[model samples]
Target: MLPIRECVEQTSGYIPGEQPRTNDFIKLNTNENPYPPPLEIFEGLQQELTKVRLYPDPVSTQLRKAAAKVFGVSSVNILAGNGSDDILNIAVRTFVNPGETVTFLDLTYSLYETIARVHGASVIKIPTDNRFAINQPIICPKAKLIFIASPNPPVGKHLNRDYLEETCERATGIVLIDEAYADFSDENHLDFLNKYDNVIISRTMSKSYSIAGMRVGFGIASIPIIEQMNKVKDSYNLDRIAQLLGTNAFNFQEYFKVIWQKVRQTRSHLIESLKALDFLVFDSDSNFVFASSQWIPASELYKKLKERKILVRYFENPRIKDYVRISVGTDQEIARLLEVINEIKSGQEFT
Candidate 1:
């Protein structure tokens, strides 16, 4: 066997949420939209089938143009990727030198640190203010790149805008905002791209457009930054079928808006329902709820829920060990999950 680098050998890989490939589980561990995307996406697949024999456009041109029309930015300012994770990897490679520091909020996105490690860059894992209602900016003065999840993960709350404004004014390095869940949130940091040349706002069609299977994400940045990142990506990063589906989904904002509003309404109901059960539910700005309780241990609930074939995310990281993150599923799915919880409370035993 070939020898591996010490960093790669010792590092723990990023673990995505469980994906059981069966219909039996009420799956909500991953933050995916429960609604189907617009009908055009499926209809376009038949036409896209004809062009599979050829290579995809090295750079996704038409898709970027459609994205430009939707984002109200020039095509030059947008850079498409296989997924936002690809953009994160490209950002680290583009901005951070081999030994330079890449900083991000700890507990926000585990993949950020994993990608930094892959690039052989040093990582500075900063803490959220208080874990739950935490809001703070990256303070690593020497960092070459900073990735901020606007509506942070696990906790599912928006960052304090004042800190972001200060970051734009104070930070000397690149600022990348992960807006993967922003479509579900009422807040966004897109305006920062115009105000700061160092800022890059990344968006994904996975959650909002219900196209996670397509793997298309794009970044909003200063033209020069996008251009540099463009030079770092694979020639054919996004496939032809992805380009067609992504473009159609990007253009059909009305469909997304309707589905998103439904999810938001369901989110409010789920939060209240959980709170009424005496769980400590955090105020969510994203499409999931972060809740814990002194009465029932999250781990036990997670195990019991899994046994019953209902899946919600449980992070083993000590900081949030007591909390479980539940994705916003369809109204019927959420209702079923709540019913199971009531059953668990009534008689099911917990460790």
Candidate 2:
């Protein structure tokens, strides 16, 4: 047998949102954008299909420049990735040496923990206050890097300005702010770059741009930091097709603006509907809602919903075992979900 590291052998690994191969189920498990991206994204992918013979720009120069324009940062300060997952992986590998400590919030992105374990880095998890609020006074000055997701998943709460400011002020290492869902939220920390050289903000086209399939993301930081991470990235991480589609989709911000507006509207309606049905919905700043119910255990609901061919996320993690996270989908899909819930409550639901 291969000499796998103990961490690799023992760990369950990060379980990503399920991608059922069939289209029979209503997929609210992953927080994927329900709508397709602008027609140009697909058209450009088609146009770029013939260019696969040539190597993609290893540094993603054109994508970086376009992202810099969209983000209002210098191209020198930007680094593109296959996805924010790649960006996160780069941050961990570039910043933290084995035996160093990496810190992030508890009940946060689980991928951070998995990455830390892989690198043999000590992880200090600061448990969130009330499970969604930052557990303040993060005192881990020994940390080599910290990852915080704005509008954190499963809970979808944004970190306040003071918490973000204090986290940057306290940490001695790279402070990575994952803004994967920032387009749906009112809070943004990109401006923190002006105040702290240690700060890096990572953004993705997955959520708001409706381009999750393209696997495009980027990070903005000081030129030195960007350059260092760029060095560790796999050659041609962002393939030519991804580069073309991401650049083209990012250029059309107007279409995504409308898409986000509708998604936000649907989010609001989903919250209201869930509350009306006696579900305890958390205040969310992302495209999904984290909610619990007194009527049934989340595990049971998860199983029953699956039986009905409607999939939402239910974590088996002890802290949030009572809750299920539902991604906001098309209005019609949400309506159907609500109807199913009603029938279930009436003792006549669950197909």
lDDT of 2 by residue, 156-222 (tens): 8887678788989988999999998899877789899999999999999988888788899998899
| Model 1, span 1-351: residue lDDT tens | 112376677668999898998889998899989999868766668878998999998889999999999888999999999989989988988998777888888668899988888677788887766564345555778889988897888778888898888877778899899999998888898888778889999999888989998899998899899989998998899999999999888778888999999999999999999998778898887889999855679999999899999999998888889999999999999999999888887664443
Q: Worst ten-residue run, lDDT, model 2?
A: 1-10
Error of 1 at 112 (Å): 0.6
List residue ranges in candidate 1 displaced over 4 A. 1-4, 133-136, 348-351
TM per candidate comes to 0.96, 0.96
Alpha carbon lDDT of each predicted model: 0.86, 0.87
